[model samples]
Target: MPVIAVLVLDGVPGHQLTAPGLAFGTAARHHPPVAYDVRICTAPGFEATGGLASFRVETPWGLDGLADLDDTDTVLLPGHERFRDPPPPDVVAALRAAAARGCRIGAVGTGTFTLAATGLLDGRRAATSRRNTAELARLHPRIDVDPEGSVVADGPFHSAAGVLGGIDLCLDLITLDHGMAVAIETERQLFLQLHDPTTPATTCAAYTPPGSSLAPTTTWMEANLRHPLTLDDIAAHAGLGARHLTRRFHAETGLTPLQYLLRARIQRAQWLLERTEDPVERIAALTGLGTPANLRRHFQRQTGTTPTTYRTAFRTFVTNLTPRE
Candidate 1:
């Protein structure tokens, strides 16, 4: 069991307070007793957002609760009203001590400000709410602030952009703790619970929507995943130089054209593996990976399992869905 301490100040962000419990709880229940020790530890300072402000907040834990954490544990900081101000000396020391004990530190939205003040984020890439990105950069010059990403994880520290991004971070942590299958189910359950039945659930792909300059190019890549694509080919299709294409593609999708193409190919392979009776060799060629060995290598690298294993798990998942639910 992994222990997670959600350290909330007065104005705790709703996402920080809820997402961990939701994501981890779903994992715990769906996986048959992978107990998670999640607790809300209250401390002084901060203001509440959303409907939480209307009521008095109370929790049995405090900052002292973080003392028991080890490397496998996580300490989460939620954005509060006073997050913009520097963290108090005791708070900073406590965070530092937790880090020294190998506990991972995570922050959501403005909570990153408190993490940054502790100097733990120095020389690390971090992310925060888009609206506050520039200020985060200016205040913590040593921290490399990424405005484009919804979440950034460097070493043992992780930071997310907003409420939704915080949930994504938690899902990522679940994946790290268990595996991709558990994480995907957790994500699917969350989507099912949060969205209307009429809405379709989306996959966890590095998918980019339209409106970017690279939209047409991405669409073309998806349609032509069977072809072995090169940088020059993608650049020509986009009517740009290779250098310009890489820069623009990365700006829009946070991935190079080739990287995006490979992921798209793998995603296609996943769909084929789940829905069709295609052999590994056939699926490999269909996805432009050329050989079964090649497909297995990249598939394992991205998904943490072989193609056969993934298909087996998917089958088991479908079979067990009714009883588990």
Candidate 2:
């Protein structure tokens, strides 16, 4: 059984990820030869979108899982609300490596834009949501955008229109892997399972962060990344004791509060480096890194390169994607 690694980022839509997995699972049940070990892999330093109704997913795998993958396996990127932002360097690098290794890459809705950021779909005909087709074409002119294609397949790159088209894309992938009969059977099983009354509603309590959850607290931290915050300040915001907050925060995010804050600041710096022409000094101040030296030190330690170097490479990549006069 090959692994179907579904890469989800911040603000990942609930349905986009679930549909493909359910479809593949149903297909595998019908045809054992096409079994897939589906894994929901979260991006490094994954954070929630901080909506009142937003829930968290505890992903068993991270980007490190992609470092060693079977070429026969597939990597599917579901639509994330943050798709407009340039993907983190680690994500871009992982996808680039997977593409080079001959992995089948698929994207849905805004996910198409994220894949395009990798430049893998630059010259390929891809489809996204009907509304975003023109914006995608405007951003990545090298791509052959399909304004009306609900599900477009160009070489190894398969794309879907939106959340609704996700199942179609997965069935198409099943069709590519097996025969049409298996795909048809998979769809049938899926529909039956959906309408099955015996299938009980799964409790989301495990996924829901507790009332004391550090989710809202983390959102607060991100909002005040430029401010000078302390452990006591964070604990106060969360209404937990300092030591209690540390333990809870680490348990949830795998990082201590201060550690998470520093990393968040570094990610903020990365965002500024890629999206804006801000100098290191201003970025450092804005991210609460204090000074250029402090920013360079932490940035280099975390990113393995300097801030200016990262920005220059990003600009060069974007420039190459642009059509010149």
Candidate 3:
């Protein structure tokens, strides 16, 4: 089993601190017989002060309780309220030592700041919340900060964009360790819809009010994703002129008709990739992308990876997870 050490600091966001446990723990439960052991660790004098508001949190383990870096598989750093300030020297030293010992390090939200301060991210790509991207880049000029990605992994170091992005990062780690099936099952248990990491949060919002003007047309588009769809077809289905439909769709969905269609198609393709073993050619045809080449181009642009690579990685992970009879 992998041992995960979550380092807690003063003013740490409660959600970030708990997210790793929830993700890994839930995944382990679904997989049967636990696969990971997670523990919260802090320095001897550490006292928990909640972020966003002042509240108290208590933990059972101190820094002395941590296993040697070689024994610990990963160390998670959760973002604290005072992210602008450098972490205590002891914590920084510990993290540096852990990295040197070949332990994987993960930073959640502004926890990237703490990780960057150790110079481990000096020449590596990292991610932080979009709101703090400029500051992160300005502070660490040698580090490549990706503003658009929700989670970024370069070697043994992984960084997540925001509080919720911590979940994405943990789920990704679960996928890497177990497989797509386990990750998808964990997501279902958590009541989360699997989303493409590269897609912006606003673009993934599926909020359509009951009486919204675009609801009916949007419904039709989903049902016809396998067909060769055109803007005119959407307009005709909605009983409106093409020009009028475009305007209303934009007003209601915050996306043009074509943009919404593309998003829908991408989502459908992701589902097929996760749930079926169909070849790229068949998947492309099923999702109305026309051909394998088109799917590769668009899927790479949307998710930052090729279809074959995605399938191989996910399937291989899952295959390793199957228990022996």
The candidate that wins on TM-score is: 1
Give per-residue CA lDDT, model 2, range 78-163, as digits (tens). Answer: 88887899999999999999888888899988899999999999878998877899999999999999998478999889998864
TM-score per model over all chains: 0.61, 0.58, 0.59
RMSD of each: 15.2, 20.9, 17.8
| Clash count, one per candidate | 4, 0, 0
Query: Cα lDDT for residue 233, model 1?
Result: 91
208-292: candidate 3 lDDT, tens digit per residue: 3335777777877877888988888888898999999888877776678888888777766766776698888898898889999
Task: Note the residue pairs that clash in candidate 1.
Answer: 11-46, 11-47, 11-48, 47-81
TM-score-sorted candidate list, best first: 1, 3, 2
lDDT of each: 0.77, 0.77, 0.74
Worst 10 residues of 3 by lDDT: 198-207
Model 2 lDDT-worst window of ten: 199-208
